[model samples]
Target: MTWTIAGSLAVVPAPTRTDLLAEPVAKALAALADPDAVGVAEIDPSLADTAAFCEAYGSPLEASANCVVVAGKRAGEVRFAAALVLATTRADVNGVIKRRLDVRKASFAPMDEAVSLTGMEYGGITPVGLPAEWPILLDRRVAEAPELVIGSGIRGSKLLISGAALAALPGAEVIEDLAR
Candidate 1:
């Protein structure tokens, strides 16, 4: 099926609000507002689940990419970074992240800390909100979708950008099989 933004059929209005106005997702989206990265569309606030969000917006899960921000400890220094992987493929926390941070173990950032550090609401977090110093790992497939609907940096909305544009963000580098 062809992926189209909510308004292609004039069924939904283009998102007037920036996703960051929402929270954790907001902080993530803050970075994309510059260069006007791509067009963003707002959907029902209640449909934030990966599948629901896509269906409501008339996109497929494969067309949606997920961003996860994780905190890992490396040589006694705690570090944070974001992972961009296919929504269908989980981030390789044990393998990729573990090696990347040079840590014994790694996993999703604790909910409380993720919220506190990124200042984004849970379920709303996106890579766009991470600190500039942190690096971003992008799944090669996420770089292929013609257009992707990602968190607006907020759960209340999602942003539309070509996979290429999403991968071009500062600190982003392409990786292969970067997901579980």
Candidate 2:
């Protein structure tokens, strides 16, 4: 499938570019019902951050999505979840997320914890290959986008996929007002 969202980067079929993806991401892509729908693009690791990536690659900021890890505690148990939101907004962790997780409080998980748990690099975490038990909270805005540039689970690359595909990922749940 041809992706019109490509910026200056060369987009290739993800299944054919597993080297560009983190192990977990590559495995997840291979298991997808339609792996051909996803695309991978090489990038400078230093430009992996949303603003830098968009500016350097000539991609619009609105077409980029960020996946953030959140940790919420209920009683003594901690629950982790991944929130997918447009780069233009922030996840409503204190409100909707906390409520959804049934925790007393919810906050962005520590970088170390997030990276360790997801087996993905910091600034390169994506919902695609998250732990099976972890919920993937996708913002309605993100689910409605035509195509979005997301992390490839590695800093040196990015993934291009449609919102519908993301919404259909295992454990994904489209939530209205997930971001603000």
- In TM-score terms, which candidate is top? 2
**lDDT per prediction?**
0.69, 0.95
Q: Write the per-residue lDDT of candidate 1 for residues 1-180, one digit (tens) a residue.
A: 233644341222223444324554444444454434455565667887788776665677777788888777877888887888878889888898778877887888888887787766677666665667878888888877677767655566666667787687778877787886
lDDT of 2 at 51: 97
- What is candidate 1's CA lDDT for residue 172? 84
Q: Can you tell me which runs of candidate 2 are displaced by over 4 Å?
A: none
TM-score of predicted structure 1 = 0.82
Candidate 2 matches the true fold with a TM-score of 0.98
Deviation in Å, model 2, residue 143 alpha carbon: 0.9
lDDT of 2 by residue, 1-180 (tens): 776677798998999989999999999998999998899999999999999999999988999999999999988999999999999999999999999999999999999999999999999999999999999999999999999999999999999999999999999999999999
Model 1, global lDDT:
0.69
Please give the distance, in angstroms, between residue 145's alpha carbon in candidate 1 and its true position after superposition.
2.2
Clashing pairs in 1: 20-26, 23-120, 24-120, 24-121, 25-153, 27-129, 28-128, 28-129
Deviation (Å) of 13 in candidate 1 = 11
